[model samples]
Target: MSLKYAVLAALHEQPATGYDLTRNFRTRMANVWNASHQQIYRELAKMTEEGLLEVEEVPQESRPDRKLYRLSDAGTASLATWLAEPQGRPPTRDPLLVKLFGGDLVDPASLREEIERHRRNWQEELGRYQDIEAEYFSKPEQVPFRFRLQHLALRKGILAMEANLAWADEVAGVLKDELTSRP
Candidate 1:
């Protein structure tokens, strides 16, 4: 998905300054999309020029003026149209998987170390997903629809991590057995 659509989606909830939007994106949309601060600022300017979003300047006493953005009618319509379209499958680009596929080219010790590292990474991700789920459950009434969507996404992520961890464990087991049985 384009960064414009993601920004529009975030603004759909409420108007927010660029900094606020960046922080929100990090928390709510981090799993699905990511944008650097510079990218977001640049997009905000471009989107404003395109008339897709409206910016309102909020004066501050001792700080720089904040330009809060809200979705214009055009932006809302654009987002709605995009949402109606079918989503394409995400392309896979996993370096670890590629390395694993080329296992025979690497030393056995290095290969095993990589697998162990992957297992640890997945375990950490699983923990983060579990924490997100718990936080969502704390205020169910505040985000009924969003909570459901988040839960579903978290479920898929957790399952994927679990599967990766399982595969890594199995590979590690085989490698250990082979090393021990070497004549």
Candidate 2:
């Protein structure tokens, strides 16, 4: 999907300043989409001009005014329309996977080390997801109904991390065996 839809969906959650939206993209929406702060700010300006977002200027004592963004009527309709459309699985373009496809060109030991590093990164991400779940979703009944869907999305990220770890373990074992069997 387009960044426009992602921005609209984020604004739908609640009004936020550009900085707030960037923070959410880094943390809460990290699993679903990635966008730079510059890109988000640009989109906010574009959407505001397009009448998809309403901006409120809030003055600050020590800082410049904050432009708080909220989804306008048109934006809500736009988001709803996009949500109703069929979504295909996004194509995977992992850099590590692409590099591995040419693994014969590289030293096996070096490739294995890279794989281990990748595994470690995924492990860290899994911990973050688990922390979010424990902190916010531990008590299902306590969670507001509106947030249950978000919980479900987070679950997908957790499952993906778990699956990646398992796959990494299997591949690392194969690489280790290869290294040992080399005459």
- Whole-model lDDT per candidate: 0.83, 0.90
lDDT of 1 by residue, 1-183 (tens): 889988988898789999998987676566656899888999999999999999899999999998999999999998899989999988999997788678777766787898888788889878876777677655555676956776676678778888988898889997788667767
Q: Can you write out model 2's per-residue Cα lDDT over 21-102, one digit (the tens) per residue?
A: 9998878777878999999999999999999999899999998998899999999998999999999998988999988788
Model 1: worst 10 consecutive residues (lDDT sum): 135-144
Candidate 1: lDDT of 136? 66
Candidate 2 colliding pairs: none
| TM-score leader | 2
TM-score of 1: 0.85
Question: In candidate 1, which residue pairs get closer than 3 Å at backbone N, Cα or C atoms, i.e. clash?
Answer: none
> What shift in Å separates residue 61 of candidate 1 from its native position after superposition?
2.1
